[model samples]
Target chain A: MAARERDGLKAVPYRSAYRRVAWFVVGALLVLGPVVFTPYWLGLLTQVMVFAVLAMSLDILLGYTGLPSLGHAGLFGVAAYAVAVLSTAHHASFWVCVIGGIVAGTLVSAVFGLFVSHVRDVYFLMITLALGMVVWGLSYRWIPVTGGDNGISGIPRLESHAGLPVSGPTPVYYVTLAVLIVCGVLMARLVRSPFGYTLRGIRENEARMKSLGFNTWLHCYVSYVIAGAFASVAGVLWAYYNGFVGPTYVDLTASSEVFLMVTLGGPGTLVGPALGAGAIVLLKNVMSAYTHRWLLILGAVYIVTILGAPQGLWNLRVSSPPRGTRRTRR
Target chain B: MSWWRVALVVVIAGATLVATAQPVSPPIKLGFLAPLSGAYAQNGRDILNGLLLYLDEIGYRAAGRTIELLVEDDEAIPAVGLTKARKLVERDGVHVMAGALLSSTGYALAPYIDSMRIPMVYPVVSADDLTQRKRSKWIVRTGYSGSQPNHAFGEYAYRVLKLRKVATIALDYAFGWESVGGFERTFVADGGAVTQKIWCPVSVHDFAPYLTQVSRDVDAVYALVLGRAALQFMRQYREFGLKDRVLLIGAGTTTDEHVLPFMGDEALGVITALHYSAALDTPANRTFVAAYRARFRKIPSYYAESMYTGAKWLVAATESIHGHVEDRAALVDALRAVKVADLPRGPVELDAYGNPIENVYVRKVERVNGELQNTVIATFPKVSQFWKYNPSDYLKQPLYSR
Candidate 1:
């Protein structure tokens, strides 16, 4: 499982070009998603897009770098609730509310990331797991603001930017698409940059990066904050789309959902999680709608999907191999 | 295109084909915001059924205009419920809404009612703020008033049935707190000694931890929780042999049709206090019972009864204004003046505060005709919102003492 790379199909190195073409097609479809689906169906797809963003962001920490801090949902949930509280309670503009959510998710993750980046494997995971639980507990008990187990609701919608005539599903879909595109592009550029190499160096052997006289913690911490920012954007979309946020968003279960998404589409492929999220969310919605035994079916599907395609649903055969063994190419 | 590209395009085209089959509606559809797809799905489903029954019976016409309903499942999460409501009102253009079977959603959707001004006629949100002094006009209850069931239980237990001591175990929420709070006010005011109270959160799946927590000295244990959570609590309550030891009784939220069908022998012989017992001997009730049985192949719950009643009364109120609901003030006046002696719940009438003041029935759970339900034992006529003891004085504090 660890050996596969260059699109996780070690036999097919030129598959990177195929991956680019696949992404282009997916991007076009994403833009046309609203026209293709009704408000309800579009709403479900919007959730898929949101989680896709989350899973991609998580890829930075778990894939690009080996810091598998388990409490990513803490940032996600706080961002969601922060948007709700800020917009409804403080009457901040939607964009301001969103920035507030991003800042919150980043700062919260950064402080904890600073502390946890110093630790290795199990300790980092345990600290994050603990922090996630703490956030969940606070949200549950803090009835006045978080609305307790009830959650905060009735958040206002963000209107069109620059008089683009944004009012309904089409606008929200476009906005979400724009956010995902920008973040995806930014992540792609960041991963291909020298900083990306440093993060990969840390992942391969933090000892080597340190021996090279580089502060490895800074890279990991910086990537963690970036992931946190991306996650908070997803959170903002969730808050607006759902028009609410609760303690459950920050709970261990939510953290597990991210883990599931990532595992179903893991190991350094940026856009793989988006497909993974799409598969999981679509299967979940359709299966739940059809049968009473939906949870069982979902569990079975997750296991089957995981076992069948160890490299995730995206890495199934699409193209032939490159000529050379490997080349870190342009 | 290559085989892989063909497969990809086929997949996308398949998704598009699936998406286009469902038809969207006009009429600013009233969304039935409910937890219709989870454990509490039955209750939410029934509530939506009640709404649908109203829509069908009246030909989808309300106040001389066509009305369409769009139902969204909240799955009983406050966040999900809130999201569903906002989507219904904002994006879906639902004029009004109701449901989300959990009390947590009551508070979640409250601000949205104000935000939209679409006037959600809550099917079963008995939260105090919903009908208390801080009540919103946009939020009308076509269901049981929160404090009434508790006040009824307490009054019947202490004043009429002459029970001396009472204890309570309830979900910790506005519903549980208000239910028991209403009871404590009545029981304590009527020279009754209230022995104990237990407040459990919604997630406590097991009740054994708190079953023995109630003292054996109390006359009866008032069970206030409901749904699968309530079912689990009751099964364990009886399994521990405490049901026979201390008589289990409360506002009958669990003992009613919404949950009674779900609880077989576990709920046998439990006394409950409620406004609508499935056994209420009335022509309107019999019609309701028969129609509900025929439509859903199940007995109607008190929640269903109240919803049906609300619909019937809403129609009646509209007719009183001669179907000219074009005047908002007049419609409200008509709603306030509603009095139906022949409704399913027995002599339903709204007081000055728009809360229903109806007769209370004391029912003992006995399997009649192979189904567990509340059988009427006693009746109290014209029970008011302010019980023998006013909760405004008592509900001020968070918790009550011995």
Candidate 2:
């Protein structure tokens, strides 16, 4: 027992030192990535950051609260469409577009949360799927507003708002990096908070949390809204970066894609989803460049990811805390 | 070890240098972008095969430069299309670009191509405004507009077919809306009343709900369905027993050669209008059909023919410039200025809007020599994007939608 405590004490400083180096390298890469990579790669990196934010937001619900949302893309797409319409049609200011988009996404999430907070497991998944399909149908059928299948195009990049110079891929990459870092830090803090512990407790045993007088439904509702807001942030960034928005964003393919990111990246940890997003975006773009059978290859990757690393790629190295210690953390 | 050995080596090096004295020109990179995956893969593959066949025929050489083809799949998404287009232009540094199967993708890539100042040939996109109000300076379309063939068909339907009443059903998107709008305007002008209109979503799996809503009293039903939906709609229309009663007529794509082989007796007697058909009995078409069939072992659809002719058009433009495609403005001007009378699709000339003015064929689906074909019934020669309407007046109107 004495030797085990000594080993734990010796490992603490080494882990901290390793973490510091990792942070330094990550910071350097984030700062220099745009400069080092070509425009195509820079564009891809921006997309990765956008999807990272989206996947992390999904992790908050699926990982912590045990709510597997199949409609997360609906939330993301609503914000993107909202931003696209405002910026392109109305020519609204950046602040107005951002605020309006987030609010629209949050409102939809709030309504969906009311219907889903009480449900569990497959029921929650089904309800979210139905709600998402409704959004997709609306976006596709409402021709005048949404531009139907063609979608609204030519959305200008931030347009030098406040003289930020975000017109090109390089500038956009920095902005996306900033957003990802902000969202990542906030999510990391959220998952380590007492509220986060309560969410985990609920995920572990909702009935037990209910008996302890916790309003699990209210917590779930609030978390859903928060996740939606974060997703909206990603959506707005995507709209500005891509300069286009379409119904495909809200489709089942997109929903399943984000779900796969969370599942494959390692749920319950914010960083895992981010890593998963990076992996998927890279795999998709890089593989397509070389071969036409990239989708088949992607399917193989998914099967291998599931079969080989069921606990996720992130958990392959990091040792998760024991259940007894996990509860004692707070 | 010897002056004799050094002298022989120097002589051999000199002989090799003299053999390669002429400067070799860099290969002209041509980027082909389309939906190579997803729902539109078949059409996309046909386009690529058609393009490859033409390149193969010419030995992939044009304007004294070796033409290097770079293919990218847009995946039928606008954003993906734009990204792939960027990679083709910015990364691959393609001298000229071509191929966009979907109208939405065509619209999405136009502005970007214009901003990048790259000459692109759109051989398959049928969006109307692409050559109308939203015409791009850097792009020229070798294919027919969405409403181009329909304009002539509507007039022919009212004047020749003597249809007094018609009902329209189309996929609920820009392409479908424009097609129906063109037909309605011309048919209405010719004293024909459109009795009913039905719009079905692209995701529609069953046509039973929409087919029952068709009015029995109408002279004909003008339907504009595409791809798998076209197959399902034709099959279900026969199942509903309405095929015998209603005179089934549609846009050219409703009975396109791409999906014609899979169709059964339900497709017979269905009249449609389009710019090209594999059954066209021209010498150029015969040569093209034979070559395409030999290579692909399948009948060349209008998609294939368009790309084939599109390749011819690009070659003509490139040759006119004497292979100096580095001059972007000259290349685009050459593309717009080229007019050919011997194309497989018949005579094609670009109008001021960079749209092709070509023959629109009113074809009937008939069993010809144990195979289904869009047999030409009537030809409306030199039909422009504006049809009989004034260009100014047409531009004054809003784009068709819903």
Docking quality level of the chain pair in candidate 1: acceptable
DockQ of 1: 0.23
Q: Which portions of model 2 show Cα errors greater than 4 Å?
A: A1-12, A159-167, A319-330, B1-21
Distance (Å) between predicted and true CA of A90, model 2? 1.1
- Checking candidate 2 for backbone clashes, the offending pairs are none
Tens digits of per-residue lDDT for model 1 on B1-402? 799999999999998888787533234355677776666787777777776676677887755566666767778767566656656765676544556566667766776566456656665776655566456766666566667767777767887767898778888766776788878877787788877778787668888878879888888888887778877977898899887788788776868787788887878888877788888888988887888888889988877776777667666666687665545556556666766557888886665555677788889888888878789988878876665546576346443211
lDDT of 2 by residue, B280-308 (tens): 88998888889999999999999999998
Q: Give residue B269's lDDT in candidate 1 (0 to 100).
A: 80
Question: What's the distance in Å from true for residue B168, model 1?
Answer: 3.1
For all predicted structures, in order, the TM-scores are: 0.76, 0.93
By summed lDDT, which 10 consecutive residues of candidate 1 chain A come out lowest? A321-330
iRMSD computed for candidate 1: 3.9
- Residue A117's lDDT in candidate 1: 76
